[model samples]
Structures are given as C-alpha cells and as structure tokens.
Target: MASSRSRRVEYDRFIPFRSAMDMDYARFALTMPSRPQRDGSRESPSSVAYQKLLDECILKNRSRILAFKSAPEAPASMLPQFDEPIRPQKKQQRRIPREPERVLDAHGMLDEDGLNLLDWGSNNVLAIGLDDTVCLWDDANKSSKVLLQAVEDSGPITSISWSPDSTVLAVALGNSVLALVDPATGQDVNVTEEDENQTPVLSLAWRSNSILTVGRSDGTVVDYDFRKDDTSICFYNGHRRGVCSLKWSALSGRYLASGGHDKLVHIWDACMPVSHHHPRRHQWLHRISSHTSIVKALDWCPTRSNLLASGGGRNDHCIKFWNTVNGACLKSIHAGSEVCALLWDKNKSELLTSHGSPKNQLTLWNYPSMTRAAELSGHSSRVHFLAGSPLGGVVASAAADETLRFWNIFETPKTTKPELPFAKFSVIR
Candidate 1:
C-alpha cells in the first residue's frame, strides 16, 4: 500500500471545461499498466498488482467508467488564493475625432512624390511648397514668409527637410540642385553645384546637421557631408527608377530606408565599411520587394527600433509592417486606395496614413491591432503629404486639392525632461 501511494500520479484531475472525449483519453492513459522497460526500471510486484486492479483490471471489465469517482478538488490554478499584487488597469487611448481641428487653403501643383514638400520644423515652423515657391509658416505667430522661389527653368521645389538641430533647411530642386538655408535669418547657407548628370533631386533626408542624404530620379542615393565641401560620403544605387522616399531611423540613426518607383524598399547600413573593390559604392543590407506599385511612404517606428512601416501607391494600395532586423514582414493591410504618406504617433502605439482617390481621407489606426480608430475626410483631392508638429499633438496634411489641414489627433505630450542627445557627455569639473 505504501509503495502504491508513492506512484500516485494525479492523472485524473479533470481540468475544467475538458470534453468527454478528453476524459476518456485521460482514463485510458491513467489505467495503462506500467511496462518494466518504459523507464528502464522494474515496477515492484506489489505496486504492479495494485495498478492492475485500479487501472488495467477495471478497463478489461468493459464498464469501469460507470464506477469512476469525482476528483477530490481542482488544480491549484483554479484556486482563488492570491499569489501577487494586482496590476493597475491600463489607461484607455483617447479617441481621435473624425473632423479636423483646423484647415487652410494651400495652392500648388505638387509633384506625385511630394512627401518632403511639407515638413514641420522643430522650431514650430511649417515649410510648405506652393507652386514654384517655398513658404515658411510660424505656428506661434501665425505669420508666413517665402523662403525660396525657384526659377521656372530650375524646376519646382521637389523636397525640403530640416536638419536634426533645426538650424538649417535642405531644399531639393527638380533640376538636380540642393540648397541649404538658415531658418532664423532666412539666408542661404550652401547650395550644391548643378549635377553634371542633372539627375533631378527627388527626395532629401538629413542624417545630421552637416550630413544629408539625397535621392535622385536616376535611382542613385548620395550621402553628402556638408561640414566642408559638401563631399559625397557614400552612394547607394539599387533602385532602377526614381527614388521617392528616404528616411533614417529615429531610434539609432544607423539604418537608412529608401523606397521608390521600382516597387522596392532597401534598408542600408550607415556604418558599413567601405569596400576597396568599390570605394564609393555601398550595398544595401535588406531588399524588400513586396509592394506592387511605387512605394513613396517609409518611416521607422518611434517606439520600436527594429520595426518599419511602408505604404504603396494607387496600384498596390497596401500598408505593410516589417521587422527590419530580419526583413520579415509582420503585417499587411489593404487601404483600398493609394497610401501616399504614413506616420507613427509619438505618444501612443498608433499609426496614421493619408490616402489618394476614392476617399482622399486620413486614417488613424490602433497599432498591432490594426483596427480603424478614426477616418478623417477633408482633402478634396489625394492627401499626398503628412507632417506632425514639433510639440507632438497636432498634425498638418497637404493634399493635391491645394489645401492643408491640421488635426488634433495625438495627445499633448506630458511634461518631461528632454533626453540628452549624446548620453555619454557630462559636465566637466
């Protein structure tokens, strides 16, 4: 009896919600006689004999289930005993309204890939491209100034981006020229010499205050160091068509994402060692070729360093999320129209996308869940651009209808100390 007690396997503890078939299987397993070779250990005769009567003998009788008894109690998991403190309930997300907070008239025949033409500077200024001119609107003062007017032959302003420090602005012209301007004094800082190849600069992204990445119509991407001579530091040549978008990772500033009319997005490593075989050329780390149309929208996650979001144009009309660490696609959703621009909310795990024809509206989505939170309609034409304000609460969207709208979709940032840009630096004694 003592030996039998030692092998008391709690196999008949019926888990709550278990089906009748499950109980029968459990009984079959529990009633099986132990074979001596099962664990390379011989069961004692007395224990084996006991098991035969309680398990095998009963099964052989063919009606032993009728004789079964209820288990003494449920397992510990079903108990109500406390094991840890209760966690506070998560704060619910604030719902975004379907109507925008404000709207303004903006006139321009904006280009198809005009993602950079509308940018909100860190200095609370909005830079907008209207026809052949570039205008700066200060949100604080509610005033406007024209920063640049391109000559008709020079081509319209294709793109404009502010440096990380917000001291200088980089403008790309359709004629394949770049100009750096100071925002405070509204003066030209540096203008690049016309490209000998004359490949129109289609997109611009600032890697740093003095380092800028330029995407051209010829599918070549150039990294220029403006600290001195505006020398080309690296060249990424993978796209076969015009490069429409270029965005650097806001987390580590190590990964650069480029998308284009080639229906491809390439992730490039900024710190790659130069190859002696091709000194100036650098190969891409991951080539994502899932989109079926022009991919003009690309943005790195502000919350997750390894996650990226890309959107396709009219033909594809899909938004895809990717694990940049391995180039694995995590999720994809059909937007039903051209996804012209994408942005992630800084205060929440949410995503916003601007669309083209059919709806010509802005969509706010709950991340990971991918559920629609709000669909805002205002643009009379394709909403080709989106820019978030410096304070992280408001967003400005530019559409082909020659108008810009502001929406209060994000929560106002909480009062918190700004993180040190260079964490390693400290005050010296």
Candidate 2:
C-alpha cells in the first residue's frame, strides 16, 4: 500500500513536467506526442517513440530558421553606414589666348633651313631675307623696298641684324662676306673682302653700333670695328663646327652668347682684358653642353641680366635656361618636338617656343614657372624663325610652309572701342 502511494506522487510530478514541454513544442510548430498504452497492450512502444522523434525534428528545424533571420554579421557591407560622398576636382586656369592676329602670304619669303630670315628693327622696319635678296618693310609708312641682292656668284643672304641706332643694317652673305647697308637708300655702304677659306658666314650680331661679330662654318668668331673698315679686331675659337646662332645682350653690354652646330653654347665677356695679342682670347665665361644637338635657338632674358635661354634641334628636343654669371643651369623644359626658335616678351614674364616635326606648333610658356599657357596652331610645317616687334606686344613667325603669321599674344585687355583691326598691316608689294 505504501509503495502504491509513492508511485502516485512520482506520476503526478512527471505529468505536470510533460505538459509544460508539450506547450513549448507547440509554440515552435512541432507536433505533440499521442497517448501511449501503460501495459503495452493497445499499441507497440516503437510507434510511440517514432511520434516523439518527429516532434523533435520539427522543433529543431524551426529553431534553426529563427536563428538565421536574427544573425548580426551577415551582409554587413551592404549597410547604409558604409556609404560615402564624392567631391569634384578643380582644373588649372589657362593664361594665354591661342588665336593669331594676322596671317600674311609669305609665298617667296621662306628660307630652306633655320636661318634667321626675320628681324624687327627698333626703327619700326622689318627686314627679311628672301633667297638672294634682302627686303625692307617700313611698318610706319607701309612701304616695301628691296634693300640689296647677292652677286651672281655669291650664295643667298644668310642673316641680317640692324644697328642699335637703326640707321644701318649688317647683312651676311653666303659667299663669306659681310656688307653694311643704309636702310634709306637701299644700297651697300661698305663690303668686306671675301673670307680666305670662303667659309659661309651663317650668323652675325652687333655688340654695339660700331662693333660687329660674324660667325663662320669653321666655328671661328671674328669681331670687326665698323670705324676701322671691316678689319677684325679679335678672334674667338670655342666651337667645333659651324656657328649658327649669336646674340649680344644690350642690357648686360659685356656678355655675348654663341651657339654652334657641334652642340655647344659659349658665353664670352667682351670686357675681359687680353694678356697677349696672338689670336688672344676674350674670356669665355661659360661653355654650356646642355644641348645635345645643334643649338640654333638662343635668347637672353630682357629683364634678368644674367639669364640666358637656349633650345636644341630635333633629337635633343629640350629648352634650357642658364645663369650666365655663374654658369648654373636654372631650368629645363622637355619640349616634345624640336625647338626651332625662342622669343621672350619684354613687357611680360612670358616665353614662346616654335617647334618642328611632330606638332609643328608654337607654345607660349610662363617664365620661371615654366607652365604651358597656350598652344598656337595653323602652320602645316616647322616654324623655324621668330621675331618680336618693338611695338610692345606683336610677334611674328616664319615657317617652312612659306607663310608668315603674327600674333598679339601679350596684348593687355582693354575696354571695347571702335578701333582699327589689330591684324590690319599693309603688305608692301
């Protein structure tokens, strides 16, 4: 009797626990177990066990799906917190205008190579060498006249330079002779005897109104005193090949720069005293070898007394600026194409370069900064020669295409008014 009473207590406790478990299974979408036979008479125990297994499987699958939906780590990168805003970049400002002011039909004016065929005289006259003839164009009066012509046996006129006073012009002929001509009368006032070797006189520069320097093919430079009747006062020998370009700085007065086909640029000091008079030397302050090819393009900065700029030929394709006082290379620019000529604006800190081959175009660069300001295009061939006008802002270019184009690139802006066309310049026939 006591045993039966204990069993009844145990049954009561287990029944309540089983009922709580069934409620939990129902909430989880699981099937509840059916009633089982106490004495194994109504049904087999295996069937009761199978029913219990099915309820557990349903409960486990439901729990797994609930856990998956509440996961915190999945797809974290797709959240709104990962988004960012983008900003735009600013562009560089252009400094120069690209259009040209005038285009002239220089049908017969172009030379075959990189001879300085164009020069602007301080007296407002333009001198151009066309083959065997040297012509003068008066900008003030709009009149053109043939200044002089080469002799039948002489080669074409190679270079021209006007005196500082602008009263006379020094012309270099192909037969290795130099002539002084009067602009007003269009006649040679005096001519030098033929060179002993007959080496072509490719370049000439005036150190002053009375002193002139001529460069020859054998790389010898001779200084002549106009007051002494074409007699050479001194000789400078530093270049290995033809001396093709020469520039004398009026600002510095004593510095003279010469460039040669052997890829050398030398700066000479005319103020240096000679120790003896036997092919005696004028001091060569610097021997610049920065240019790898013929150094045809040379110019001195008008504002900076010691600064000099030079450019190389097709293979070199570089422009270098130098400090003539110390012979230090201050700046270098990789002009993609051949640099044929260089011009510096007197009124602004701007420099212009005329190029050949690939992009036969003109590039305007800001000084010191060396930034490209503008690119002027129109010429179909290499632009070899360049000259800047004394009229403040005008520059002219002569190209291999036999055309002369003028650009007022450095002109300052002004209020609009009824003014004559800037491009209107009379072509003297």
Candidate 3:
C-alpha cells in the first residue's frame, strides 16, 4: 500500500487548480493581490500586484475570411453529425377518425345573407346566433344563456366576435347598429349610423382594447374608438361591395385584413399616417384581386405575422394563402366545396377548413405540405362556420343543420412551454 501523503498528491492531480486552496503548503502566495498600486510616487503602495501585461505582442498583418487574422489556429469542431442517419422517433398521429366530443342542437344556426355567427371566446365560452338572439354557451360547464335578443328594428344578428380580453362581446345587427355587450350584465352599449340610406354592419374586428373596426355593407370600413367621444378614427373605402370578413394581425396589431363580396382582399396598415395638416382617408397597403367570386373568409397566421389566408365564395371554391409582407401568393388549394372558414392549429403546423355544400366535411391538413391528414364528417348539411378556443385544441363547428359540434382535433403534449405569440416585443426593463 502507498503512503497516505502520496495518495493525497495523486488525488489532487484530478481536481481543478488548487494552489490557492491547498493549506498544507509552506508558503501561501496570493495569485492576484489587490492591496494598492506600486512605485510609490504619490500613488499607494503594493496593495495589488496587477496581472502583468504580455510584453511580446504578435498579430498577423494579413486579412482572412471570418478570422480577422487572429493568431490562434482553428479549433476542432465538437458537433456530432452523420450522413443518411435514420432512427425511430415518437411519432404522434393527428387526432383522426374521431367524432365530436359533444354536440348541441343549435337551431337557427344557418348562415344567411353572408352572416356567420360563431365565435369562441378566450374564457372557454362559445357564442352562436339563433336568428335574432345571441347565445353564450359555456364550454366548461356546458350551460348556455340567451345573452341578447334583437327585436323590432334590430332583427337578426349579423356577426358576433369576442374581444381579445373576453371582457366584452361585439354584436352586429341587421339594422346598422353595433352593440357592445358586457357578458357579465347582458347590457348593451349601442352604436348606430344616422345616414339616410343606412347600411348594415357586415363584419367587426377589435384592433385593440379601445379601437374597433366595423365593416359596413356599403363597402365602408371604419376604425371606431369607443374611448373617444368622436369615435371614428378613420374610414377605408377600398371595397366596392359589402365587406364580409375582417381580421387584424394578432402580434403586431398593425395590419388589418378585410375581405369583401367584390372578390377583393384589402390589407390596411394601422400605422398609415393620418396627418392633421393635410388629412387623408386611410389607404390599403395592398389591394389583392385574386378571387373570382365573393371573398369572405380571412385569417392571419398565428405563428407567422405576415402570412394570411383568404377563401372565396361558392363560385370560387379556392383557399389562397398570401404573404402580406410582399403581397405574394404562397399557395392555393381548390377546395371542392365552398370554403366557409379557415383556422390554424395553435400548437402545430396544421390548418382546419370547414366547407359548405356537396361534401360538407371538415378537413385537417398538414400546412406547408398541404397534405390531408384527416377528414371529419358529422354535420348533415353545409358546415357554415368554425370557431376555435384560445388554445386551439378543440374546435366548434356550426352548420346549416342547426347543430353545433365540438371536436378534439389537436393532441397536446404532456408538458409544453408557453410560446410567445408576439414574436417582436421590447424587453421589459
């Protein structure tokens, strides 16, 4: 057996440098002393003998790519890579060949006169229009209540949308009145148009907490600020026909997309300057005349801020994806039936489309590839509308059959990190 001192010496070799820590050494010298300065010419004494600067300096005088003529040689790469490597992975199948988890007999849920009244709120509640009444169905409790019932002049509910915060619901009526309903009290703050030949409010979208964009049937889109007394921020008159669909970019809150029955999709920039010196009407960034028929469906990509999807009406059964950054057509698929609505999966790179007439089925497709992953069929008639929850796992479909169905379309992982929905945001100091 070796001596204990020898074993101690051998053990110290395997550890990190311990010259300053080894207490048994006869002389303990400080590697870096910070007492004071040296040379005592009005300066302090040797408080700290600072690290000595290298006397011999060497630098290459020539230029090189990415190196800037550093003296050190290239270091070996530690990246593990291989060619033609194939291995088994945990393949997760899309929730396929399944029926809706729950179904409710939703009477008077048909789409008429270009009105789609289906909106799922962030507070786990589903809202649908029953001809003249706006009903709220709580998804967590499966209980519903008649939130509002239109009477007399306000006959039918044209469109319904929940705000991002889910504190207020915007309900559009047939008689050109936009009612902002507080879900807690079922009270409405009505906004009316006083024009002699009044047009109906076809679509509505919330740009921010205070700003709401109301699209009228006469092709006039107004950005109304409820916080202000004047209310009207600006107006967009690009569409020649009824503006049917409106959606704002979720991340930047800059681009507002609108689709109209004139077969045109207009992308408006909220940052468009409205000068007080020389005021002008808000102009669209891009006027896309791609669809041959009425354009109604509009949705901005949840992951990609500049990407957008628009679907045409019956005469044109095509769903075209657009890159709003440069107004480029990314892809276009000819859906057999009239594409009613388009929704992106919140967790995966998948898209869900509900169709009308002929084959009234819901199809989930793997995006980018555009391959049909699964086809769902439960509705007897044309599936006119689709609304997904905030998380996008479960989707609610309303059809002409006057029925509402909920499908668990997405398979969520056990644990997931919350992704930043807005890709660009300043660091909060």
Error of 3 at 224 (Å): 0.9
List, residue by residue over 250-330, the lDDT tens digit for candidate 1: 989999999998999999987887689988888898999989999998888998988999999989999999988899999
lDDT of 3 by residue, 1-429 (tens): 765764444345556566546654323334434322335555444432222222122323332235654544645464455664798898886446479988998887755646769999889888898888999999788799999898776668888888888888998887777888999899976555545576888888888767888888889999888877888878886999898899999978999999988899999887888657536478888999989888877888888899998888888999899999889999999988788888887767888998877778998888898998888998888787889877557889999888999998865535767778564666654
Model 2 worst lDDT window (10 residues)? 29-38
Query: CA lDDT of each candidate?
Result: 0.85, 0.82, 0.81
- TM-score for all models, in order of appearance: 0.75, 0.72, 0.74
Name model 1 segments beyond 4 Å from true: 1-93, 416-429
Clash number for each model? 0, 0, 4
Model 2, range 245-325, lDDT digits (tens) per residue? 999986978899999899999999888776675545575779998788989999999898999999999789999999898
Q: What is the lDDT of residue 69 in candidate 1?
A: 70
Error of model 1, residue 257, in angstroms: 0.3
**Candidate 2 global TM-score:** 0.72
In model 3, state the lDDT of residue 369: 86
Q: How does model 3 score by TM-score?
A: 0.74
